[model samples]
Target: MALTQGIPNNIYGLHSAEEQFREKACSIIDADTGLQLHLAVTEAAMDMADVLRQFDTSDEDLKVAQILGMRTFNAFGASIKLTLSGYHQNSALILRDVMETVFLLDLFAGDRLLIERWRFADKKARMRDFSPVKVREALDARDGFTSKKRFEVYELFSELAGHPNMKSSWMMRPQRDGDAVIGPFMEATALEAVISEMGRLAVQVGEKLDHFFPANWDQCLPSRLAFTQLKLKWIKTFYAPAGGP
Candidate 1:
């Protein structure tokens, strides 16, 4: 008798494993909670776009806002798509980029010097000093806001998800099942956390806008009201303890 007689010679096991992975991915990606989060982010981007359209592109603040809004929106959309496709780690990386954009926007909103520096950067050359940490620190110092904790948390999460270190590799470790090894499944919680953080940041940016440009709110009352209502609905549906059905 041959010693290797017990092994199956067909590719059925591989096919079965692939099917299991697909089913697992679908369950998390198609869940109601995830869908709600995605919708909330989408609505935020739409409202931001509407608000941006009200400002002339030639205005310095509007120019900065446009760049920040476009970059944040693109990163957020990419993150959502990556999460839905079972690329959770890369999604987190994109979410980290979203957070950076938010911090940059906040800094620009508070500091005239930074805004001028950004606006006057060489048109043909890329900005080489747009560090998120530095921007956050400057903004916090200028505004007396304590955002160090949140920035640290975002940095740690991004490193774990985006780096090529052991921590990132270990997250996808396969499970041993006799002679077979099953790969790691998608992590829905990570994507949920990203969405929640992004939502919070968006609300903060909106509040800042209202505080800094009260006249804009009055001028654009109808649009502002619509945006505020959308934000409130999102909070009630996904964040409030007694709200979601």
Candidate 2:
């Protein structure tokens, strides 16, 4: 068999069954023109990471916000990696984790006292007041938001991956009659949905960071620029709907 570079070419007996899968998968995904939007979204995440890193850590609040931003970025990166490897269900679970972090980060950014509470909250205290449901309730009740269910995305992802629900299982056994599929198999539609979901939530993350660093918002210029450029390129290449910046 021709060797796929950067992936183990030599394999003994059982290991031969798992040769070069990730390298080959990435090659196929990279070559697919139809996935430019997904590619653009991935690029946007990377660029945002760079932007998040540049924020000045002048105070404890800024430091916490920066840490939360970094954590969210890393979680998002993990989800992308899993999706690329055809582990959509696991990726969605990571996305669910990220959704909660983003919501809490938003609340903490808006309320300095919350950040202080979070920094030293005991396990029981955290579960009592800072659970996912509580965070959503607190954020939605905060001033300046639409007050409607602004964080139902967390629940949606929970159903899709976090909970032991039928929909979550469908990621593995997509076709009811089909066997439960395991690990690293190509599923274009599922991959697309995962990537699209990551891309959408990533935008929300950017917004949260932007709000967190309002005075330093100009520091995010590169991130916003990268997102805008990617969107324009996607529209130009794929004839996607245009949206103003």
Candidate 3:
């Protein structure tokens, strides 16, 4: 199988050697299987979600859940409809797991079915040509019209903390200025808020998984969800745990 070289300038611009190496490694693996790895990993994640939805999650369910948990933590594609600017550096990693999990659930029917099978093997075409406009139109054309809910937050932390301005606008308050500590203090406070919310979300997620998967809920839920966090690229963005720099 021939692999494409030379990174495009439009998107994925100027990745580091390490990033390129990892992407290439992933590319090579996917090339042989015709991106079936993505589909399989995606399917596995859905199975895991299903297992979570079930009352009696078996050993096989737990195994699949763990694997899916890991995969969901590492597969995502994000686009900015607002602007080309303000793309988070490691945002891809952060949403990888959740996006794959959701995508598999919605796009595929518990099977590795494609919502658009043509996208997988269109050698002469490019995914970039699949415009956002077209996608929006398709969604609009769907029979089930109103009361659709958007997947706003990837995790509980995002729901609580809300999206922050990465470029913090420093306010010049002479009263608060005490040895270049204002920026640090604000950033720290923001971080603290994230951690607090994430902790709460963790508890909620644990309870939900327990409700869904009773058999392996106790045995695998912690490890599975923990793996989800581990594969996440930027934990700091969501809110680093307490005592973090």
Give per-model TM-scores: 0.66, 0.74, 0.28
lDDT by candidate, in order shown: 0.60, 0.70, 0.34
What's each prediction's clash count?
Answer: 0, 0, 3
Candidate 1 lDDT, 1-245, residue by residue in tens: 45565557545665565466547656764676645654564556546645665665566766667666767667767766565545556667776776776777777666646677777667433235456666666766776777577567666766667677756654343322223223434455554555566566666555444333335356556656665776777677667787536
Better structure of 2 and 3 per lDDT: 2
lDDT of 2 by residue, 47-138 (tens): 66557677666777667777887888788878877776667888889988777877887787688788878878899999889988888888
Distance (Å) between predicted and true CA of 33, model 3? 44
Task: List where candidate 1 sits over 4 angstroms from the true fold.
Answer: 1-38, 50-54, 121-130, 143-147, 170-187, 205-223, 233-245
* Model 1, total clashes: 0
Candidate 3 lDDT at 72 equals 40
Ranking by lDDT: 2, 1, 3
lDDT of 3 by residue, 1-245 (tens): 55578766534543343354345444443454423323333333333444454434444434444444344423322211000122222222234234334333322222222334423536434243223233223343453544332333333323322233322121111123433222111122222232232333333233223323444346546544643543242234334688877
Looking at model 1, which ten-residue stretch has the lowest summed lDDT? 173-182
Candidate 3 colliding pairs: 72-97, 73-97, 75-96
Residue 160 C-alpha lDDT in model 2: 78
- The model with the greatest lDDT is 2
